[model samples]
Target: MLIWLFLAMNFIITEVVKGIKHLYNEEVAESLISIQDTRKEFEGQATIVVFPIVRFSKKSPEQTANDLGAYLVDNLKEVTAFNVVKGFLNLSIANDYWLDLFNNSLLQPDFGVIPSNGRKVMVEYSSPNTNKPLHLGHVRNNLLGYSVSELLKADGAEVYKVNLVNDRGIHICKSMLAWQKWGNGETPESSGLKGDHLVGKYYVIFDKEYKKEIEALKAEGQTEDEAKKNAPLIKAAQAMLLAWEAGDEAVIDLWKTMNGWVYEGFAISYKNLGVDFDKFYYESNTYLLGKDTVEEGLAKGVFFKKEDGSVWIDLTADGLDQKLVLRADGTSVYITQDLGTAQMKYDDFKMNESIYVVGNEQDYHFKVLFLILDKLGKSWAKGLYHLSYGMVDLPSGKMKSREGTVVDADDLIAEMVATAKQKTEALGKVDHFSEEERETLYYNIGMGALKYFLLKVEPKKRLLFDPAESIDFQGNTGPFIQYTHARIKSLLLKADYTPGVFIDNQVALSETELDMIILLAKYPSEISAAAKTFSPASLANYIYEVAKMFNKFYHEIPPIVKEEDEQLKRLRLSLSDVTAGILKSGMRILGIEVPERM
Candidate 1:
């Protein structure tokens, strides 16, 4: 498909060259070279009229073509005919003019990177809480984080991926208390549940049982409001927290058991997603570490001690509400722990920037954090960015743990893999491959589809998880892209062609083929843009476009039919090979896989 596009683009350039020659007549050769001088004349006219394609402001396909056309026309000749119409620009390039530009693009070293090199970037995401297994929200967070980090790496920046584990908090304690109250000596093995799901089940059981106990109190002549506030289950949970805070052995032991299970579950999910962390910070280990920093700030007058012995930062001057850094009891709050984590990370890496890939609900928290950091005279505070993405809402409603509608991460992945296996079997192609090979391929395609669907949208936009619609195998989905790649692989094998060997034969390209080639060539540019904006969806959309274009080209052009020289066929095959390489690499950034067959 890529080869066909390259040939088509080559043909378009050939046609454009012929047009330029006809427009210039005998003076075409001199006019093309002389155009380099903006002052030069082209046949009696002071300017040569060139028509460029129309483009939109939002960086659509038409805009890209128009920009490229303008760039080519401008460089080839001085006083080139180029003007913007509404948004479209028509630019003309002489036949001889295109010959030089095409030669340069074909031979350029590290195409596009030199012109687009930017700064280093770091994206941190997948900060899972240890109280429950990961859910749909974590899936989007991880996908976007991983993809953005990869985009930066591809664009000549040092990229670092990190994860923060919310290993402590009252929520985690609830899971532990529930486990102790209900869980006997039963293990995940005995229960026949995935480790994470088993732990999550106990957590759900805790919520249900707690609510039931409250309702029971209301039924016994107690006022509904009082019963809700003074339920025995709620009291018991509070007592457990006090015990845990007081270093009670029993409470600590229970906390360890459930937390370990949740962590183990998280490990499985991360492994399946092919996600890794350059560094891992646990909230428990860092929660108390911020106390000293707050104390220092208090002394420096960066923060003030409230009358109740709590510490507070007046953020009203910064157009935000004042934030409490510590409770009157000297207990660290969420923001306090984050302060310590930020300091620790900077001390360790001294990175120019630190990005927190968190949800948008905490926008105020991050704003205050950076302001407080700035108050502390930390120069790097300016570089701290909170990449707040929107929440993932299901078609039914927002996921509610109490209502039991939260999609468990492990369950989701398992279901996707199962669906993939069933599809592969239905296609009857699994029989031709070994069991191990077929399973691997199925897993890749299934997981890729899941990740791509989530990451293909902008991070700041709320996502609707329509399971059936999202996992569609046809039309603008991950499976569609995988199928295109698989089809290319199948074609390559059939052609028995080798890449890197230049062919001497010339072939004409259809318009569809040229469009695909142009799209493929724009990959490096798209990757660079994605990295610059910290938006993985941009690249995700670009890959989808490439896949769509390649598919169209494939349907229209026959690679193996009526093609003459082995060299020409091989050249085309090389383009497809490169396209596949880019697809596989780009998908990897989003923690997706491309199956050789799907």
Candidate 2:
């Protein structure tokens, strides 16, 4: 989202700088001039801090503000009146300015959206492993990555959304091996289970049986770590990984079949969750990518090979320990695949920035990855970022995929929709909706509840998600903002509002009405801030505030739809119209949908 600021704030700041130059014969940077919303106790729509300008004025603070106030009201038509309080200058903007914004803002389809700024970026998110279905942890990851991409687009950056599926390695081989050993052929159709869930079931089975082997070995007097290393199941899974990589036909066929099932399962889960990817890079295809690069790094002395033949990079002087890039057995590690994948993505898109939306668990991993790339003299390494977010905790506690205790993404989506159905029916508004309409409404409300709840929090914070608490129709929840959008739509429908209708400047205004226009003006800035921080929570909270303000304006005035004066009624209707536009545009980028009714 782009926060191309409104005219008044920019205009005021520019004029204030000019005023300072003329009055004090001084040079001032525009950034030093602070313009903000007026305090409730003050008598203006906007407030300017006079203290920053005091050094330019030879007079006392109050006197300096008074002189500036006189200059502004006399010279600028937008400044209708002004008052001085201590060192602050409160300027009441003329109604013409407010009325013009309400009138013209609706003319453009993309009201607060900024045009393209020619910056190309790639956001990698929802990078799931084929060994298991996505879980609550994946939920937060997907929502954050998708929304951040949308936010960057709104800020006028050309963005590509990509996903990296961990389809190879020992983890996947474990699931494949367990399925083969335990099952007499259990396909997704045969078991009536989602493909990913079916595979995930075998993964848990592998862990359970693997644990038994470890415990039995431990009982034979070996240490715990020694038992783990000697476990037969682990060795078999490792062998399977080697075979699959070596292109053994039987292992390769099984890998393809199982990975296919998981992909089918992942598609349904992603659609239900309202997230997607433009391109997918599998670890299997890119696992060998960084080998040549490693050789190049070795020749350049960026990498060192120890006596055992493992390639490594020394970074202790850079405040980090040495990191291994390749094993002595000539196999790539996890970071090796990442190093190659990063290079391939850059080679494909050549984006200005490549943001990795992974959990904080990989913070050190990315720091090393980017630093290694930089040491290898890749120019794009400078633009690499790790958008590290904290984990999402449930009331039950942290989830474990190997224990089969994680909440499946598909199941959670169904539960949210079901919860939405129950709450919406209890609320009694959806009784008139059709079966299909009711289902669609339920999904929108439910997913809106889920996405908004996850996106509204600062991405770096570990959030405890309460599904029931998030579905409420009031408070700062998703349903509240969704409902507010519906309310504005209902109001616009009743008033028969037409876009681009002229709003008279002479109409009498209430503080709440003007307060809404002022609040609406902040939408552009909100987008800019959200994009800069790579945090959807900033935009999420701003929309909630706008919704709250709209509701206050709605309830405070009785029958705005049927006021005695035509001009006042039209202005209110237009205000409602613009509010609805802002709410819809804001929520859309967060991967949420707001219904026109209910």
Candidate 3:
């Protein structure tokens, strides 16, 4: 609001100056105004750069700034004082203005949520394969996707969260084949393992045996390529895939059984992670959908058929090589299915934008997918975006799924919860809590720590995840923010202030109090910036700053309940209450929960 006020003051100043010296139009004057927050050492609320308009005033930057500042203070009641720092015109706003904004902000229920902008956004994340359990990488994907979705919704977009399960293809067949040959009728019930873990075990087994077979063939003097291509295990998996595509009942039944187990496993993990989807897309259902689109492209000269009858799109003009859409056998490739799925999603949601929350490794894949769709003359192709994020590594090294070296999502979550319990107990603060309450508190802290750690980094930057470090109660971590929130809640509870109690504006404010209010005032702007960049990291860090500032204020300022002046005590309590509310709302945007007690 101060920024907008500065803009209005600048406009009025320009209009009045026009009567004296008409050197520039209103548009040019508007462009010349650069308003920003005043630096901490400066005694002002906002500063406007005066150098950009000095030519129009025919004076030195400092002189022009002083002139403009004096004019503003004379005309505007809100402008209390002004200072000229070189080309910067810093204006201190009246305390009543800030108090009024703070009071009004408390009255609005949806304080930070923007009004709906009449746009729909579809986010696709957690595109898992049935051959494996959700791993650490998938954890990042799901968290980022879900957080971005919530972030957009906070900025007033109708968001649709969807998951496209990679439940079919050769990789899935490998798991099925391994189970058929070596499982000996083992099920999740028999092995006491989750369904996805069970399936992932067979997938690893298939890879191990396949590698052994290839080594044997190499020992017989065959080339590596020959061994890999002619391996009996791989051939069997390929045959199983063909059988699956041919609609063989036995293969279908097996596919359904194994995928059912995976689905159940995924559901448990998703629920624990606090992520959800409004719709689910399966590769089995959507794989063949793009063939029609490919055919249409062929007719429209967007694609060409080779001698083997495989359909291809020439993208060299777009700085990429030719891409395969359909094989000679009339089977759709990954991109083919993606093309159809993109169209299908648009038909379903009529969204203005579609974001795919995928890893950076698939950057080229998405580039080709979007280019093909665009060349095919689809009007909505421009809205397709690949939210390409970097991979998350552990301190040990990168995780490999086929070798079973990946950190399982469920296991990591359980470890976080256990770590939370251990740390919370060591703190010795929750001894008075009931067993159930303790359990819930541990869960909230654990999940909150995990989600915040993953989301606090920029989406495009690679990160190293250290579980031990993440659960710490200090630094830029989730538990720290949660603890700050809990501290504020405790203060408010002890003060026994009634909700919606209006504080008199006559009381003098401390520097800390005004600083906290200023930070609180920027919450809506933070949300808008986070939404624009599709980065929850912005909000994550913003909330952390708020929490940190509140903590500092709590330590430096007088105790709320011990204060003698009732009005000052109420004002401090009001600040604590509003800070807690903002922490809760900001954490919610990141899909992290802040507990009332830590």
Among the numbered candidates, top lDDT falls to: 2
Best by TM-score: 2
The C-alpha stretches of model 3 lying farther than 4 A from their native spots are 1-27
* Residue 212, model 3, lDDT: 100
Model 2 CA RMSD to the hidden true structure, in angstroms: 2.0
Shift of residue 587 alpha carbon in model 1, Å: 1.8
Which of the two, 1 or 3, has more lDDT?
3
| Model 2 global lDDT (CA atoms, 0 to 1) | 0.88
Compared with the true structure, what per-residue lDDT tens digits does model 1 show for residues 261-348? 7677778889887787898888767877788779879989989997899999888877888889999999888888888888888887
**TM-score (C-alpha, index-matched) for candidate 2:** 0.96
lDDT of 3 by residue, 192-288 (tens): 9999999999999999999999999999999999999999999999999989989999999999999999999999999999999999999889988
lDDT of 1 at 207: 84
Which lDDT tens digits does candidate 2 get at residues 273-381?
8888989998788888888878888999999999999999999999999999988987788788788889899999999999999999999999999999999999999
Greater-lDDT candidate between 2 and 3 = 2
lDDT value, residue 276 of candidate 2 = 86
lDDT of each: 0.70, 0.88, 0.87
Looking at candidate 2, what is the lDDT of residue 45?
83
Distance from true location, Cα of 472 in model 3, Å: 2.0
